[model samples]
Target: MLLVPRQLLRAGMTGDVPYYGGRFSPAQAYAAAHPQPRPAPPPPAPTSRADQQLAALQNLFAAGVLTAEEYQQFAARVTP
Candidate 1:
């Protein structure tokens, strides 16, 4: 007697399509037939007051001016 796994048996019986096996399934084929919409470009990074404060804190930490404890405290305060 030949035995197939339940998932394979179910897949075979049902009309549902497979994805990422080796070849594209019916859904994938259909999607490929129709062109997909492109995603919008990401917004520019913030240059506001909060961002400035964060940048200042980062610079201070990097410059070895701010101790670890002071950096942590400043980070906690500045982080919205």
Candidate 2:
């Protein structure tokens, strides 16, 4: 394994590494000045009133509060 001096490693980590002869690389300078833009995240899907009512009916059926027939009837009414 190649070994580097502790001071050199510290300077590199802290972004203060000295150029070979007081000169900055062109690519490094350009990259520091210009950064790419990130795209915005997509918006969340909106829930409809019918969807909320159906979900409530499903929860009731799952809890044994509503029979299959009643659940289906309520679901049908909740939707268009």
Candidate 3:
């Protein structure tokens, strides 16, 4: 038959007393008991027809297909 001291068992269960020369701090014990929550993933990127139209207008202006006045009119129509 073998017997262990209640105090030693209590200390081990509660991680209050150091064992084998290594101690468990309150923070470490709490962390071991409760883990931190993971951060939420970032939101997806936005997509809009206005963005596509703006890109198209820029391309058209660069290609000399649309004049300044035409670009302005197209921008006004496409913008929210």
Candidate 4:
């Protein structure tokens, strides 16, 4: 296990361990000014009102809330 300089650590048997997020990191992890940019994640696909209704109908059928005939009729209105 890495250890922080005794001067940096509080007066205790254990030393101060550096952390990055929730995990430990080394004190030398950053030495100088640096910049690294990450691309943003792609946006989610947009959904149409018909598509939303279709998904709702499918869920209802899966949950046994809509009969097969009712689901088929509703699905026809949403699908091309």
Candidate 2 lDDT over 39-67, as tens digits, reads: 88888776687788899899999999999
Judged by TM-score, which candidate is best?
3
- For model 3, the local distance difference test gives 0.87
For all the candidates, what are their Cα RMSDs to the real structure?
15.0, 11.2, 8.1, 13.3
List, in order, the clash count of every candidate structure: 0, 0, 0, 0
lDDT tens digits by residue: candidate 3, 1-80: 44988897898797784554466677788898999899999998876777998999999999999999999999999886
Q: If candidate 1 were superposed on the true structure by all CA atoms, what would the RMSD be?
A: 15.0
Candidate 2, residue 40: the lDDT equals 89
Model 2 C-alpha RMSD vs. true structure (Å) is 11.2
- Give the higher-TM-score candidate: 1 or 4: 1
Off by over 4 Å in 3: 1-47
Tens digits of per-residue lDDT for model 1 on 1-80? 55978887888887665556688877779999998889999999875987789899999999999998999999899877
Clashing pairs in 2: none
- How does each model score on TM-score? 0.39, 0.41, 0.42, 0.38
lDDT of 4: 0.75
- All candidates in order of lDDT, best leading: 3, 1, 2, 4
**Candidate 2 lDDT trough over 10 residues, lowest sum:** 17-26
lDDT of 4 by residue, 3-74 (tens): 786665553544444336764344334433344577899998776887889989989999999999999998
